[model samples]
Target: MTGAKELDRFLAELTTERRLSPHTVSAYRRDVGTLLEFCAREDIESLDQLAVHHVRRFAAESHFRGLSPRSIARRLSAVRTFLAALVEQGRLTANVAVHVQAPKPSRRLPATLDADQVASLLEIKADDDLAIRDRAMLELFYSCGLRLAELIGVNVADVDAADRTVRVTGKGAKSRVVPVGRLALEAISRWLRVRATLVKGDEQAMFISRRGKRLAPRTVQARLNHWARVQGSPTRVHPHMLRHSFATHILESSGDLRAVQEMLGHSSLSTTQIYTHLDFQHLAHSYDEAHPRARRSRRRRQKTK
Candidate 1:
C-alpha cells in the first residue's frame, strides 16, 4: 500500500478498534499530518524511511516557534502513537519516534479565584429566565467543584436537595457525590422555578439554554467570561478556575488533603498534592503576620541585644 493509503487505514483502525473520541482522533490526525508534510518536503516517501533524527528536528523547530513544553510533549506523544500503529501493522521494523525524549513540561501553578472574587462573580443578578439559569450554573460549578463536562451532564434527578449533595459522573464514567453549599442550593431552587415557567418540556438537565435544551460547555464558558468582566476580576474566568478555587479553599480551611482528593474525584493522590502547595503558601503568609519570631521588629531587637 502507498504511504498515504496506509495512514488512512491506520486512522480507521484508531476509530473502529481503539474507540477513541472524535476530538482525540482529530488531534492525532493533525499531529501526524505535520510529520507527513515534513517527510514529503524531505523526499521521504514511506513510513520506514522516517527516522528518530527527523522527529527530533521537528520538535526542535516547534520549540523555536515558541510552543510550550506541554504542547510539544503532546505532539511527540501523538507521533509516537502513530508510529507504533505502523509497527503493529508490520509496515515498519521499529518505532523510531519511541526513542525520542520529550522535554519536561514546566510546572505552572493552577489559577484560582479568591473567595471574595468568587462571591462577587456569583452575585451578578439578572431578572430574565436565562440569567437565572446562569447564576445556578456558576454556583454549582464553584460550589461542587465540577468539571465542565460533569457540570453540563447534570440531570435534575442528580441533585439531592434533601441531602444537599450532587451526584456527578466524572472522567472515565466514574460517579461521585459532592456536597452543595447553602448559597448554591438557593440559586438552584430559584433557577428551577424560573426554568419551569420558561421551558415547556421536562428536560432532565438541571441547566438549560433559552431554547430549553441542555447547556453546552462552550456556552457555559462564554457566560462565565461575561460575568467575570462585569465583576471586575483581573483575569478571565472559566469553569475550571471555579473548580480550582473550590479545591484550594477546601484544603485551606480543612487541611485535609485526602478528603479534597476524594471530593475532586482525582484517581491519584499525586494529582491532588498540588493543592497542598497553595495551602502551604497560605500558612506561610499567616506565619509572617502572626508569629513573633517572624516579625521584622522582633528580629531587629534581638540583633541589637
Candidate 2:
C-alpha cells in the first residue's frame, strides 16, 4: 500500500476506533506529513524502508530547521505512531522510529489568577440575558476547572443543580462528575430562567447564542476576554486561565494532590503536581509554620530582639 493510503487508513481508525479528538488527529496529520516530506527527500518510497539512521537524520534536520524541542518531540511521537501502525499491518518488520528519542519538553507552569483577581473577574452583574449567560459560563468555568472544549460541549442535562454536580466530558471523551460550587449553581439557575428568551429552538446546550445554537469555542473565548476588559482586568483572561486558577487555588488550600487530579480529570498525578508549586510568600509561610528548625530560628530572633 502507498504511504498516503496507509496514513489515511490510520487517521480514519484514529477517528472512528481510537476516538482521538480532532485537534489531536489534525496534529498527527501535520506531523506525519512532515515525515513523508523527509522520506521523499531521502529517496525513500515506503515507510517500510525506513531505518534508525534515517529517523535520526530526520530529527536532526527538523531541529536544524528551527523546530523547538517540544515540537520535534511531538512530531517524533506522531511518526512513531504511524510506523507502529504500519508494523501492525505487516508493512514493516519493526518500528524504527521507536529508537529515536525526542528531547524532554520544558515544563512551564500554567498561569493562574489569585483569589482577588478571580473574584473581580466573576463579579459580572446579571442585568441582562447575555450577562446572565456569561456569568453562568464564567462561574462554571472557574468553579469546575473545565477545559474550554469541555465547557463548550456542556448540555442542559449535564448540570444537576439538585445534586450540585456537573457531568463533564474531558479529553479522550472520558466523563467525570464534578461538584458544582454554590455560586456556579445559583448563576446557572438564574441563566436557566431567562435562557428560553434567546433560544430559538429546542437546543439542549446549556450555553447558547442568541440564535439558540450551541456556543462556539471562539465565542466563549471572545466573551471571556470582552468581560475581562469590561471588568478592568490587568491581563487577558482566557478560559484555561480560569481552570488553572481553580486547580492552583484548590491545591494550595487543600494540599490534596489525588483529589485535585480527580477533580481536574487528569489521568496522571504528575500532571496535577505542577500545581504544587506555590508562590514564594506562600512557601515561606509554610516553612515558618511547619518547619521545626524555622520555628526555633524565629524564636531565637525574637529573643534577640
Q: What is the TM-score of each candidate against the true structure?
A: 0.70, 0.66
The C-alpha stretches of model 2 lying farther than 4 A from their native spots are: 1-67, 71-100, 278-305
- Residue clash pairs of candidate 1: none
Candidate 2 lDDT over 137-179, as tens digits, reads 9999999999999999899899988899999999999999999
Lowest summed lDDT over 10 consecutive residues: which window, candidate 1?
1-10
Candidate 1 is scored at a TM of 0.70
Q: Write the per-residue lDDT of candidate 1 for residues 25-49, one digit (tens) a residue.
A: 8888887877787788778878787
Clashes of 2: 0
lDDT of 1 at 128: 80
RMSD of each: 6.8, 8.3
Query: Which consecutive 10 residues in model 2 have the weakest lDDT in total?
Result: 277-286
Scored by TM-score, the top model is: 1
**What total of clashing residue pairs does each candidate reach?**
0, 0
lDDT, candidates in the order shown: 0.87, 0.90
List candidate 1 stretches off by more than 4 Å.
1-97, 288-305
What is the RMSD, in Å, between candidate 2 and the native fold over all Cα? Answer: 8.3
